[model samples]
Target: MMKRLLLVAGAALMSGLVIAQEPVAPPQVDLEQQQALRDAVSGTSRGITNVMRDAYRNPERTLAFFGVTPQQTVIEIWPGGGWYTEILAPLLREDGKLIAAHFDPESEVAFFRRSRTEFEEKMAGAPDVYDKVELTTLNYDPQLPIAEPGSADRVLTFRNVHNWLSAGEDKAALVFEKFYAALKPGGMLGVVEHQARAGTSLEQMIDSGYVTQTKVRELAEAAGFQLVSVSPVNQNVQDSTDHPEGVWTLPPTLRLGDKDRARYLAIGESDRMTLLFVKPE
Candidate 1:
């Protein structure tokens, strides 16, 4: 039947007659990228516990919104537990670079020292997945560059803004400027943090870990970045942002212990705001 149709079309063409044809469908997705993300996120290398959190974290969508590609240099700030590291490591292992700016291993604080040590151990245990990750550290001194100035294609931080702001707004603003300095012109800065209601004071933000979008914008703008977009992929509307322990009272942290545990479990993760900013070219 195909041969017959071809012959008819040829004959029609020879006779100077036009033939009707079906329109080709345009591609709706980048199959290559989709498969890459799927393999990285769903791979057996990730911890089962981290995989279970996929429902709320939505790593795939969040990374996509940040315009992460396989070939760009990405710097992740404060990779405490290496949860995202599991996904990012394999994704960027083959072609791109994943620079983890983690806690200082020599910090006077015991938690920082222990966490960094454990993170190194985790990487050493899984060389096939994590060997290529270039490890670094982030600190309060904005002058201390995380990577070479204007070197990274993307700078990402998850649920870390409140910690920076805890010291004060100046510290947070300086850190934002550092993130800006580490990215190439027009490169992106992706942030995910617990969302606070508008009018929440800076003191409340420092205490609760929930920051207003307005405050985030102010910091980024101070750092010379323009807010390009915001995503709700990680948002939880059920959160009223007034828990006794703030965002920590939700699942994952559940800082309340067994008290009202069921209620916090039902609420799931805290309401989060995901923002993407671009350093101007």
Candidate 2:
């Protein structure tokens, strides 16, 4: 609920603006909601492999950290392969809504086209789970907004910051502003992304598929979002963040192909930062 939107300014005020907060506290989840998330996470109907990755992804805690409940209008940006969608689709199926802002199917880029096709097929294949998922795309037109200005309670993006960072900071900032425009007053933008340690250069970040947390903050702040909270629920202490093929060198991607495969599997996924930003009321 937006009821407890305690607007307190953060210390690092920039250009007379400051990050606001609703207080940094662990999100409380009732037994019913907890059980519901667990059920969704453990559901066999979801992609079997996706379920296995919960060890690294921690969907339940991550969503709870974002204060996700069953009664909010949420939009998932670029839900490639619907990894989180498998969990989010059901959690909000009954009382809430999930609008997946995916890639343009009509795009000239082969990768974008394929990604959209696969996601669409996944949704089409799972009618019971995904029939209610409203699909949309961003940046195609100015007149046609992503989620109708100020309509969503939360706009979520997972492991996508690097892709945006690849397109230059100006473009990345604009993308975040699009999200800002999509959210309601006191709405949230939850970003879960592969993280580089502070001071990583933009070029290195883009090349490595990991973004520096500082850059992310700048982009969000530029988009007019207030930093609300950061969660270590997705952090991987084992990851060095200095990989040969970038984050893809880790499991789930494992781009190296037996080039120290066992070692990478042991290290698991890349270290990630889960940040919550608020569109101040």
Candidate 3:
């Protein structure tokens, strides 16, 4: 009995020693960096209307959840109207690189052409804030690549999944695969999209501009990404996923105009799912 007790004690000590030797994960974003990020989000250059959406978007918290730092190369997919671009460009200008992957300038579609022109004009208007931004083009074509393989530390897309689904399931899958190829091993893809009700059908997901969390996960997993985390930072519990004009019936878009505009305004923005996925190392 004495010998057995000594062996048990020795095993316990060795187990503890091994645990103590295990390396700890360093802090991804320190306190000082967090403060700086917040400051950038709240900066006056973002303009009053853009800043107003901060409460709903929770840009600082969302970026922090995605583990975004100023030093990492970030590719923002389809920065329509430069809403997030206003914050991202200034923050990453000094230490990091910001790549804006926008619609192809040669798009024959009138809306795409107009949007591309407007975005170029916006950047030109604010050269001080946007001059360093590297412009690239991304379209539905799988042959056209967005960024170099394994070159980006992070790939971010906001409210774009539904459009891809509208294009086609295969197209959506191809885009996610492209995102997978753009990131370094262990790098992350951050997605913020309008959230559909749980178990929503693919038809509704495409039509309503709101996608189910499960569907998004399935797509990412199929693209060889592991869903690491989901955040409620941009969630709006008030949205019931039954809007007549779809998610756009809500604020910012207000496609309904003054018809029950007050009601939609009360609900605020559409409920959003903020997800993080990682490429396996």
Candidate 4:
């Protein structure tokens, strides 16, 4: 009887201690440091004001909407020129792992080569920040070898799927399947791409730099992922779906140069789809 009473008292004491523990804080990113990060990636030393205005405004919310925490084993696909890489690497530095994987440029289209040297240099410049980052190459073909199955916790791709569609093998879908196969059960795949209007065909997506949300959902569902959520945080409602040069004619790519600079600037970046999907257990 005495031993039973002692066990009950000990259990209550442990429960009280657990309840008394304070909740831990979310990761802290200082305003100044965030500004510095923007400046570092925006190709300008004085970029914080302009970069921060956009980054902190809408994009961060897109990331938050997807429930990206600092604890996942995240693989970011096609970290071209490391734009998002600059932000994500540091954010995941402390307790999380960030893997920056790019197309094997030796096998990719010619354009990726232009950024190859720059991407390597940018990441090399911050060895400490990327100490936990792993750089892997995606073969763009199904037969190519990659990590073991069920290895990652999340796979994220931003603004690059259209290029895969253009590659003609439906490498995009194959890659999506690979992502599904690479994650543990219940792992996530997060995507942000230029969004096309409903019913835009796949060929048109390759040509226009826009992909319909339906196409993406279909591909993911086919790969055994369950649609979790979609967010409009990155959506741009002003796009009229009638650009002469398509989505590339907008600010970041401005393919036409000075012809529609003012117009594209006013439109800002193209409307994007932010989608989240999870592998079922």
TM-scores of all predicted structures: 0.88, 0.89, 0.89, 0.79
Per residue, candidate 4 scores C-alpha lDDT tens digits across 89-157 of 766777677877776868546767667657787777768766677787776767753456888878888
Candidate 3 structure quality by residue, lDDT tens digits, 219-266: 898998877778889999999989999999999999999999999999
**How close to the true structure is residue 156 of candidate 2, measured as C-alpha lDDT?**
90
Better of 3 and 4 by lDDT: 3
lDDT of 1 by residue, 109-157 (tens): 8998999999999999999999999998888775688999999999999
Q: Candidates' lDDT values, in order?
A: 0.88, 0.87, 0.89, 0.73
Backbone collision tally, model 1:
0
Residue pairs in candidate 4 whose N, alpha carbon or C atoms collide under 3 angstroms: none
Lowest summed-lDDT stretch of 10 residues in model 3?
18-27
What lDDT tens digits, residue by residue, belong to model 2 across residues 91-140?
Answer: 88999999999987887878999999999999999899999999999644
Look at candidate 3 and tell me the lDDT of residue 263. 98
Write down the worst ten-residue block by lDDT for model 2: 3-12
Worst 10 residues of 4 by lDDT: 18-27
Q: List the residue pairs that clash in candidate 1.
A: none
